[model samples]
Structure formats: C-alpha cells, structure tokens
Target: MAGTGICCASLEEPIALMKMGLSMVLIGHVNFLLGALVHGVVLRHINLHKQARAMEYAISNVVALTSGLVGIVVGILAIVLSKNKKSKGLTWSLFTVSLTAALMAAASAIGLSVITNECPFDPTRIYSTTLILWVPLIVTCVIQMVFSARCFAVCISFLGLPCCPNRKRTRPYGRAINVVRPLKGSRPISQY
Candidate 1:
C-alpha cells in the first residue's frame, strides 16, 4: 500500500477483496450450471437424431464450461491469498486467469450468436430454446467481465503500475517527448 497509487486504494482493502472473491465464485458457479444446461440441450438434440445446430453452440458451451472452472479455481485462490499478504506474482496470476475467463465468455457469446444466425431454422424450436437459455449466459458473462476489470485495477495497485491514461511520462515542460534527435543536429520536426 505504501508505493501503490490512490486509485485502487479501496480495492486493496481486505474486505473488498474478499467480497470480490466471493462474487467471482458465485458467478463461476452460475456459469457452470448454465453451461451444463445448454450443453445438455445440445446433447439431447443429438440423441434425437437432429443435426447439431451448426456445432457452434457446442463449441462455445464447452469453452464456457472450461472458463467457469477456471473462474472457480481463481476465485478460491483469491480468497485464500487475500487472507494473507499476497505476492505480486500470485496477484497477477489471478488477474490473468480472471481476464481470460472474461475473454472466453465474450467468445462464447459470439459463438452462440453465430450458431443462431448461421444455422438454418429448425421446425422443432431447438434454436429458440438454446437462444432463450443463452440470454442468462450473456448476462453472467458481462458480470464476469466487470469483475475481471476490477481485478485488473487491483493488480495495477498491487504491482505499483502506473494508471492507464497516465502511463506516459512527461518532459520538463509537461508534454511527452516521442521523437529522437542528435545532440549536435537541429531539433526533430516531430518534437515541435
């Protein structure tokens, strides 16, 4: 907390970290259950001898399941690590895993949409059922992304990294210097 900046000071608090961990775990579980339901629906259609809905939904659901499991593991790690003084590496790892989970969720959403749009309409309403189930998944994934972003903000604080917009260092005159110049030559035009 000493050298870490003020923007993430609140996230550094033990209580807040714990709350994030718990919420991540909760979302992970939700994602897992929803993923399973969607996968089961696909499996059922397969059993009934229906052509798979472009196979896109299955792939996305599998990715969602994997990401859900990762989220659960990372959430547990966060909870355990938060209880003690956390190492920078561990914190970064948690952030990375959470970030991956968020990205996977976004991919899943896109894959789900692709299946709905690209697959031919079915007389049995399988597509509609999967789409209905997907609504909750999209909502849950959005929540996961929010949590991942929060984790990223905390990581920046933990690692003493500069804030995003302020990452570039300014010269003495308060402007950034992005040009190269020979000490004996005229000033580079780009610098002007």
Candidate 2:
C-alpha cells in the first residue's frame, strides 16, 4: 500500500518518486537482514531436536506461506489503485519482502547446521546416511535458492545498470541500429 502511494505520487513527479523508490529499496534490504537474524535465532533455539524439528519446520512453512499470501494481497491492492499499470513501487516492496524471506530461510539453514554439529546432508551420501540427514538440507537449499535468486535480481535491477545492451532501430527500412549508451567514466555501473 505504501508502494502504491509512492508510485502514484511518483507519476506526478519523477524525481520525488525516484527518491521514494530508492528509500523503499533500502528499507527492503534492511528488513531482509532482520529476517535473517530472526530466523537464525528461531532455528538455533527452537528447532534443534529431531521431533521438534518437524513441528518447527511446519510452523515456519506456514508463516512463509502466509507471507506469500500477504504479498499477493498487496499486489492486488496496488493493481487496483494503479488501474492495472505495472507498479514499480509495489514491485519494489514485494521484492524487498521476498528478499527478507529468503534471508530468513538461509539463516534457518545455517542455524540448523550449527545445532546439528554435522555437515548438512550430502545427496551422494543418501544411500549410506539417515533420512534425517537428507531431508533438511534438500528442503532448505531449494527454498533458499528460490528466494535468493529473486532478491539478487531485484538488487541488481535497482543498483546496477542494465548489462544487456539497449538497442534501437534507427529506421524501419534502414539496416542501421543504435545502442543507447550509458553515462560513462564516473563509476562502475554496479555502484549506481
């Protein structure tokens, strides 16, 4: 909802919206770090046992699922306000939320490793190792990878210049094309 407001306000003035967007991005990153810390604490202290681990995993999964549902609600609200326009503000907010969720999952995995005092399950050891060894690592990696990729992509899009060249055709019938160049010689593209 905040993102929708910012984006709507931004349509009136690009500069203000740009500043707001940047701030939202920063807030998202901060939330991600906080979520990681929270997840680490929960996994380390709450889910260390074999039987308790199952319950903790279930609860965590429920929370994650609920978060996703909330994101969908926010997305829908943004869309309704924007009349179906692609909402950059809402996108930024959702991206931030997703990044935070991913970080939390990763922290959980790390905490689990610390508690186990053993290397996380290796798939190659499946035949020789216990089911307990295989399940947690596999599930953690799958969930972590999905969210990590999303967070990384959003971060790159916000902070880095486009890597793929932006090409434009000069004429409908002409063979010439132009590559719009970025401002150069100041700093690396990633810094901005």
Candidate 3:
C-alpha cells in the first residue's frame, strides 16, 4: 500500500505544476504584450519617422502578438487536459499543444532578433527612447516555450504509468477475505 501511490503521486504533481506555470505565463504574456503595444502606439502617434526604434518595437510586437496568443491558448487547453478523468487521450493532445508553443515562441524570438539587428543604434539619432521592453518580450516567449516543454514531459510520464489508470484492481466487491481456514497450506499470504 505504501508504494501503491508512487505512480499516481508522480503524475498528479507534475500536472498541477504544468497547469499553474502555463496559466501564469499566458496571463502575464497577454498583459505585457498589451502594455508594450500601447507604449509603441503612443510613441508612434507622436512622431513615427523620428522614432524608428519605436516603429521597430511596434512591428516586432505585432508579429509576436499573434503567435504569442496562439501559444497561450494552446497552453491553456493543455492545462485543461490535465484535469480530465480519462487520460487516454491526453498524451497526444498535450504533445501537439506543446509542440505548437515551442514553434510559435521560436518564431517570435526570431522576429524580435531580426528587428533589433535591422534597427541598430545610430549616432545621427536625436530623440532617445528607452528600449527595455524587447528583452522581456523575448524572455517571456522563451518562458512559455519552457513551460510547454514541461507540460509535454508530464504527458510523457503518463505513458509510463501503470496501465489500469485510476481504477483500483482489487477483487470484485463481494469477495471478502476468508479467515475461516488454517493459515498453513498457502499460496504465500504476502500477495493478499
């Protein structure tokens, strides 16, 4: 009985961890992107041509926003799958979701890199704008990718769990232990 819990314990915890991590990442990413976009828009409206860096921020954010949304949604759905009573379908769904997150995150990262490289700091630039948001955006995307990987690992762990799943495999309800006979001649009592 003591060891009976090993399988279930291993699965339950990782699933919960995955769910929480993914949900947090999703919410944070949405808010952060929205704020970052607003900053870009405000800067652009004031003077776009003079603020090429702000434009870069706006374009990179727009590209990242779409993919970030997709990743968050898939991440949330993957969390939902963790609660399902029937885990049979879970592995494939989680696998696909996690894979999508990784790809989307990679795309976002690449887009940000391209924009940064294309818009290097120049001496001719007069107005200076703090560009701290870009690093965090990339970091958030990478975090999402990491959480997705964790979720996928949780899915893989399920594959190795005891085949019967949550259902107990004890003798049918009516069968009671027969204590009437001598404890002598026996198939070892240990199994019972």
Candidate 4:
C-alpha cells in the first residue's frame, strides 16, 4: 500500500479480486478434470526429437506450464489484496495476469490447431494420444477471458466513476448541496 497507487479507502475494492479468484478456480477445475488426456505420455520420450509429435507435445507442455506459473502469481496477488485490510487497484493486477494467461492460451491453441491438422494422428500408425483436454481447455480459456474482463468492468462500475450525476455531494468543510432551489413554503431559501 505504500508504493502502490491504489487507495483502498473504500469498501468495494476487493470485489474484482474475488471474481478473479473464481476465474482461477474454474481454470484449476478444468485442468484437474481433464488430466487424463495427458496422463499417458511418458517423460523420457518428450525429447526424442525423432517424432513429429514432439513439437505438439512441447507446445502443450509449454501452455500448461505457463498457465500454472501465471496462475500462481495471480492467486498470490488476489489473495494478498483481498485479505489485506487496505488494498487499492487490485483489479489492475488481476487484469494483467488474466490478460496474459488468455493471450498465452490463445497462442497455444493456434499452434495446437496447426499440429492437429498437419499430423495424421492414428493410434495404429503412430502412438497418438487422445486430445480430450482440447475442448475443456479452450472453453475455460474463453470463460477466463470473460471473467477477467468482468472483474474490470465491475471495478469500474462500482468505484471508478459516477454512473450518473450526483447532486447532493458533500466536501470536507462544506455541506452537500443537491437541491439548487428551496422547497416552496417549507423553509426559507437561506436555510436550504
């Protein structure tokens, strides 16, 4: 809170961070739910380099590893900010992490698509593995992007700016003057 510019002066600061946590939970569930798709791959065969599937496997590994690492950072930040009594601009940090994850997943999807299309994957011809995680991973990624965006939108709508003009706004030393004119017959104009 010292160097950080975010002022946790209000109560609504962590709402965005909470949404980001939900997004993280969803991503983790997707990974855990689809673990079977990658269980059959042997460790020693990854660097064989003699097979065309190596590149595809490498891309998958990178994507998974990157997501996991990024997720750790996001989780730490979100938890710290949410738990802290004073936190400001937590949404910005969560937004950056989520944006990075979304972009990384998108790039991985493109690479994986090329590999899937170019390669003739047949269990008989090649030791092809089932890519069942593809759909879940993609769907989770899209949902994460949406959730991340939503966190930002919520932060903005709740705390960023006034949605509409506020009339009765008060300052430190002066009273809020919402009513420009006094009510008729109710009280004197000077009293208002």
Candidate 5:
C-alpha cells in the first residue's frame, strides 16, 4: 500500500505537466479552427466590394467583432472545463488580452476605412492614417509578445522546456530571409 501511494504521488506531477501541454495545444488548435470557420462564414455571407461604403465597412467590422468575441468565449469555456487552475488562468488571460487587442484593431480598421473612404480590405489606403493603422498593430504585437513570454515561462516551470515562439526567421547560409514577407508594404512593422 505504501509503495502504491508513493507511485501515485510520483505520477501526479507528470500528469499535471501533460495536462498543461495538452491545454496549450488544444487552445492553439481551437483558435485555428475558429479562424477557419470565421473565414468561411465571411466568404459565404459577406460581399467583397471593389469600393465599400462606410456602412458596408462598418457591417463587416461588426461581423468580425462578433465572431472574435464568440471564439474567445468558447476558448475560455474549454479551458476552464478541461485545464488545471494555473493553465485555466493562463488561457483566460490570453483570451482576454487577445479580445482587447482585437477590439482595438477593429476600431482602428473601421476608423481608417471611414476616413480614407477605402474598402476595409484595401491594402493601399489602410495606412493613410498612421495613428489609426499603427496603434492597434503595436498593441497586438505587444500582447503577442507578452503572451509568448508567459507561455514560455509557464512551460519552463511546469515541463522544464522553453516554449518556442511561433515566429521563425529563415536563414540561408549567413543571410537572414523573411519567408512571410508582405507583398504590399502597407502594414505597420513592429520592431522586437
């Protein structure tokens, strides 16, 4: 009986670590699936315009905002039900931060679309207003960085392995190459 108790106690930490890793993986997969679903819904329902009016642009923003909020809520619920307390807290924090960043992005996108009289999907005129374009991008970049740091710290604490950042720089020989380079240089760049 004593040996069995010892074995069970020893198993607890590994179980917790496995749960945490699975939580992270589940969150990432759920987010990706939600994004795909949102894209399909938008493509089916929303009309793309060569030139979208202010009202049409606002409608699109509303659709995006609603979809994002729904996804976050679903993610939070999933985490809360399946994850340990610490993992649940981390997931909730990430979801809240992402939602806040998305709101900022949506507002900035809408305001810029209104001001520039450009379609929200238009790459050229989106950055005509620096404040409207860059502020949300910076906010989101910061949120992403902070979330990554937190995830790495948690993984190091729980599993003793550092979590890898999602962004990767491709190097050829001694030269650095950006594989995901933007075709149009309209988006704001965030310096690490």
Candidate 6:
C-alpha cells in the first residue's frame, strides 16, 4: 500500500503522469479491443453446454468494454489537465472516474475468472481456445484496474484538492525565526 502510494506520488511529476495517462489510454484501448474480440468471436462459437457460462462471460466482457471506454476518456482528460496544477475539482473528478473504472475492471476480472474456472477442460480442449483468447482480456482488465487505482492514489495523496482537508501542521505555535548574520567585525548580540 505504501509502495503504491509512493509510485502514484512519483507520477505527479510534470511529464510522468502525462506519460502514465498516455499509457492508460493505450491499456484502455487494449482492454476495449480484447473485450470486443472475445464478445464477437469467442462467445459466438461457445458450446451449448456452456451457454450459460458463456453468457455470463459475455456480460462481463461488455462491462470490461464499457469500463475501458470510460478509462480512455479519463486518461485523455488526465493527460490534458496534468499541466494545470490547481484544478483540484477536476482532479477529484478524474479520481472518481478512475476509482469507478477500477472497481468495474476488478469485478469483470473476478466474474471472468469464476466463469472460466467453472468450465471444465475436456479432451478436445474446445474451451482452451476460448481461454487462450480470454487470458489477454483478463490480464488487460487487471492491468487497467491497477492503473486506475494508481491514478486514484495520486489524486488523493498528491493533489491538495479542496474536497479533501489538508494535513494539520505539527506545530501550531510560533513561526520559524529568521536568523540575522552579524557583520564580519561586529560583536554577536547577547541573548538573555
């Protein structure tokens, strides 16, 4: 958790998060493409015995694709707005979108894993082909989830957004004293 926070905080550096945002867009496109491929190709050829499972998988794929699309949009926004340090509200909105997309990706991955595990591997290994295709989809979804979560952490920890309260100062008393240097030949001032 601390590691994640550190990583996310590092991304706030000028071009780092912008690069991260670009990568997020790439990952989102990959997820979207994989979801579409699985839905359009693999699902259509599923065996009747596993139709129910396939349907569930298909639904999860749809969720993945939807989340991917959302991720892409948010990523683009992040890239564009990264330069504006004071847009806390916008940053908060990005964090919210990222959090939601992360949740959806996680749920979709879980559903996919459950449905995949439920299906048995027969001698013919018909399902293996589907699994082969789906492995990338699962990997992409998890990857996107991680990316989104990272973005969430960055927004929360680094962005001193108005929505979240700032950390309290450790010392509430006097401010730091500015020390004055005596002239080269002058005697130091005496303190009581």
The residue-by-residue lDDT of candidate 3 on 126-185, one tens digit each, is 223323455566777666666666665566555555533443344555767667654676
Q: List the candidate 4 regions with Cα displacement exceeding 4 Å.
A: 1-19, 32-48, 83-92, 120-129, 152-192
Give the per-residue lDDT digits (tens) of candidate 2, residues 1-192.
345654344322344334443433433343334334434433334334545534544344335333334333333333332342356665566456556655555544443333343423332433233334424443543444343444334433443337522233244566776765666666655688
For each candidate, the alpha-carbon lDDT, in order, equals 0.69, 0.42, 0.57, 0.51, 0.40, 0.76
Candidate number achieving the greatest lDDT relative to the actual structure: 6
- Model 5 per-residue lDDT at 21: 35
Compute the lDDT of residue 59 as modeled in candidate 3: 60
Task: Encode model 5's per-residue lDDT on 39-146: one tens digit a residue.
Answer: 443323434553345345445444434433433443343334335635645545544544553454345344423445443443443333333433443333333333
Backbone clash count for every predicted candidate, in the order shown: 0, 0, 0, 0, 0, 0
Candidate 3 structure, TM-score to reference: 0.53
lDDT of 1 by residue, 1-192 (tens): 555442344566776677678888998899889889887874445532354544555677888887778777667766765776467668778768867877877776666555444554453677767778888887786677667667666666676665643333455368675865567777867687
Task: Name every residue pair that clashes in candidate 2.
Answer: none
Candidates sorted by lDDT, best first? 6, 1, 3, 4, 2, 5
Model 6 spans with C-alpha error above 4 angstroms: 1-9, 46-50, 116-126, 158-192
Number of the top candidate by TM-score?
6
* lDDT score of residue 137 within candidate 2: 45
Runs of candidate 1 with Cα error greater than 4 angstroms are 1-9, 47-53, 118-121, 163-192
Candidate 1: Cα lDDT at 6? 26
Give the range of the ten consecutive residues with the poorest summed lDDT in model 4. Answer: 2-11
Better of 1 and 5 by lDDT: 1
In candidate 4, what are the lDDT values of residues 29-61, reduced to their tens digit?
Answer: 564344334534432344536666666656664
TM-score of 6: 0.72
Q: Who is ahead in TM-score, 1 or 3?
A: 1
Local error of candidate 3 at 22, Å?
4.9
